[model samples]
Target: MNTGNSPLAAGRARLGALSLAITGVLFLLYPLVRPYADEKSMQGAEAMASPAWVAAHLFGAVGFIFLALGLLGLRIALRETAAEPLASRAVVVTWIGAGLTLLYFGAEDFSLNAIGQRAVNEQNLKLLVELTEAVRYNPAAITVFGAGLVLLAVGVILAAVAVWRSGLLPRWSGVPLALGFALFIPQFFGTPAMRIAHGLLITAGSLWLASSLWRAQRR
Candidate 1:
């Protein structure tokens, strides 16, 4: 919206600030979740059912941070780029998808934490076994997993398109966001490899976005 010098420049400036803030928050979330990633905790369905491990995971907190940052950044990015029709549309859609995903993941995080906690304390390994088996055999986990994959896909698509059209960020930055999207899907359906791949993608994307924003300010 001609934000470079328009009255909305103030808002655009604010958006830039918000985006940078979110990027910083996301960076901080990494260390918070690191300590809980012990191998035995996630080894199998049995391990996953451990209340001590599951509750400690605090995975929801991470999802919440991402969701919050994504929502704020989306608002700012869209507002700043509104004049550019293509970028605006892409960003808006991406943000919407990202917002929904944030909600979805947030809910899942809560559910896992709450329910998972009970299983751990109850020592009801039997129930835990059943639930894990359901996740493996029943279609719900598959369905939900697919849904998460779709949200990530949509967000990445929108982000990729917006970044490409706006050229607001370096071409290098877009590369990681694009790659993150590509790797995220496979990671959802794959094994430990997927976790490592998706983790790298998330890290790369966050860094790129943060770097772009920092560089833009310097210019």
Candidate 2:
């Protein structure tokens, strides 16, 4: 039996652990940039116009990239760990979810932000607000974005459960991973507190995963 770690496996474990840690740290800082009001309102437009707002989306975009990469690494790591079929499947699903979410977020961070910023520069608050609402609630966008969010949440929960069952890491880490995404349910209520709480939970879960993977890699 080949018991030693292959170069590719080792690289994946290390990179995945690092990427997850970066993602968690970025998420922890996200609350600072998150707007407290509607993006289309006068106050909302003013908030988005600030340097902090721009930094927030940029940070979030980078975080999404790291998150997707981390998921890919985790999938590869799980495969090398000889995790059960269910665990492998869950990781695969998580990867897909990460990809989908990244796509949605990338658009919001780059395209939407640019348009909103332009509207702000032109002093057209109405256009900025309209654009924000349209992007968020457009029928097609809503469908696809909503699907991505659902997949992300479900994938995280499933992956957590699989990790627990497979004993790939400390089983207790799975609880936070599952509970973190579960907290997202309350965010639909559109409260800042709920959104902040959700982000915190997910960040905690990501950190836990990162720490576990880092330890495993060192071993």
Candidate 3:
């Protein structure tokens, strides 16, 4: 009869879990969809125009959407539980950082890819090359995107620590969640393997949180 125990809450938990899981999988597959090396070259533009590359951008956009929704659900679930002040603040940071990161990526993936595709179709090799370089090595873009990722990672780590200390979620989940964010360091340096590992860890943590929320609802 309680709002927390309502079917709607249970459904939200399930949705959150599924979204996080899918987001992880999509991130894992990012390398496949990403442009091959020498992307700023004519060869790269040609490759970007390929069906696979376009599909990858589309998939990445969808993944970001899922990630945004998953993080929103996570924030709601955490708020529903009684948390320490630190944990509550961490939850807010987590959702804000997650939302910003997703928004940036969603727009970049969709719009940039569309531009690249159109440039290729129109035989604007010069424009395509310039755009590719900007996307890959533009200082401003790199800084902004990197900052967002760092914020998101830090927020996750903080939230995990709070959860661990506060028992808002299972203590076991917190450790891995923190570790997952720690792995983001390697990702920041552009290490492919670390990116995949980070995705796996975050996925595991999210599933664990979702399970906890579902159990809480039943109780």
Candidate 4:
């Protein structure tokens, strides 16, 4: 139960700190390289068919995974501290968020890629729009996806709170990261440029926090 000298535990702690840096880079690239267009048209289908589309979505999915891992690492680092409870809750919420987010990303990346390929092969671009709508509008898929994103926001906010009160870490370390997650859903309505900017914000925030976590681990 003590885990004080557990090699596996120590490894996880290290990886968790490193995960934030990886997540930051991936999140920054997700939107920048993504093929963006009006997804309701032929051009949209073409964009979807491109390798970049899949790569972009995959980046997002993988980023979420690493983000959750990083949060878990943070929780471990906070163990036995006053902030432990909040960090633990943050990990749970973020893990759930990452799971839900990945489900939607799976549909977006793989399913849509298939649909795009099929549409391109058939020379019937309308299929891309139709199929995409059907899949995206699925009640269950959307509900969970929405919930997941919101939970991500909540989880990060909790992490920020924990960091703020930790007394062992910089109070401002989690602010930018929390703000970035909080804006995740609303940014969907923004322009492509705005999305890119959003990515930058997340990148900065994540890297900042990652620096703190890395230092914490070394101490």
Candidate 5:
């Protein structure tokens, strides 16, 4: 078989489809299952310290990992298409975004877990607030984290543009996913229901894109 028609390509297609689907599911679950509490307040300390908190953030980190892998597969699938250039760019941006975002996620997962646990044990609400602020507001940390999210938004947007341009796939397939990423930063300020709704949006986008890509491969 020609290299382009090899099993590897099919494997990648399936993997990408599965990865996208999984990413959507994970993202939805992250906010859904995470313990919610006002992190700055004494009453909320236990929620932050709980395993659920770490697990919630970890869902996001893992989802990003899946997204990066899915994009790589998508780039391969888009090869020779009009959208290839944009898909290529999206791959790079998404990968870099995943890396930078993961760094902050790591801190959130481990550091906050530690801090919350210690604060709970010592009954030090002030210490919890102070240390959490110090970590979150660190100039370098916050900047990189912010940049990562912005880049991720850009990446998804680029992917959406590519999908719109690709004749082989449904033009609107990427829209919901793109919208979810675009609103990611703002969603934190929204109500819990709003966040959950955002998760649903991502899931819808992922399913839309995955179905289109999968069908393209079948044809």
Candidate 6:
């Protein structure tokens, strides 16, 4: 009856436990790394330029490293132990997707914030109005945004499912994944209101995952 020592169980348990800790770190540091914007524009922003944002981004990046570890643990838990390839593949995909998305998102965070600050100043108004015009004419920023969004979409879908099925963490973790996925649509709709909503949803999900990871570690 000593199920605690079994590798499979231990892996699953370890993943479950580690998830809580990883998620907790992510939650705590997310604000530091997340993009900041003009309260008026809500148009979109990043966390660069500002010293505080830079510090947060650095801290948040470290948190993501922990999250990646938790995800790898989950992958270990799901690997070939069961007679199913599909399940294992899904877990692997999710782990990879999440990692890629996390990295991309971090980059986007700094880039967007830097861009935003350049466009605006302490007055909370657009400083470089010409830059906005340039951004409109140039497709680079749009392309970067699109790539980040796509990665986020795929990552959330895959990770949500993996977390739900792994039984290594609370089912609630899936809620944030689902919410985060759902928020992506608004990001593309090109509406300020939508971005705000999306931001809230994403923030909620990030915190939930962090919490789940932290709780897992405690056990």
TM per model? 0.64, 0.81, 0.70, 0.93, 0.95, 0.54
Clashes of each: 2, 1, 0, 0, 0, 14
Return whichever of 1 and 3 wins on TM-score: 3
Better of 1 and 4 by lDDT: 4
lDDT score at residue 110, model 6, on the 0-100 scale: 61
Residue lDDT tens for model 1, 32-87? 33333322243332344445433433443344345335434433444555324554
For candidate 6, lDDT tens digit of each residue in 152-219?
A: 45545555666666555576775665565555646645454554555456556756665664454345
Error of 4 at 158 (Å): 0.7
| C-alpha positional error of residue 140 in candidate 6 after TM-score superposition, expressed in Å | 4.5
Candidate 1 scores a C-alpha RMSD against the true structure in Å of 4.8
Taking the tens digit of each residue's C-alpha lDDT, what string does model 2 give over 67-177? 667766666656644454555566566667666666767666666666667786788887887787777677876676666667766766666765666546787775675
**Per-residue lDDT for 24 in model 1?**
37
lDDT of each: 0.49, 0.68, 0.61, 0.88, 0.86, 0.51
User: Model 3, range 1-219, lDDT digits (tens) per residue?
Assistant: 123535676667567657766766675566555666455556666666666665665665566566556655555555545544555566566666655565556545655666667776786778876765666556766666666667767766776665666444577765665566556546645655555566666667666765664565456
Ranking by lDDT: 4, 5, 2, 3, 6, 1
Per-residue lDDT over 98-139 for candidate 5, one digit per residue giving the tens place of the 0 to 100 score: 899899889888898899989999999999999888888899
Best by lDDT: 4
Better of 5 and 6 by TM-score: 5
Residue-level lDDT tens digits of model 4 in 5-39: 24565567678879988999999999999998888
User: What lDDT is reached at residue 122 by model 2?
Assistant: 84
Model 2 pairs whose backbones collide: 40-129
lDDT of residue 100 for candidate 2 = 67
CA deviation > 4 Å runs, candidate 2 = 1-8, 38-40, 80-84, 118-125, 188-190
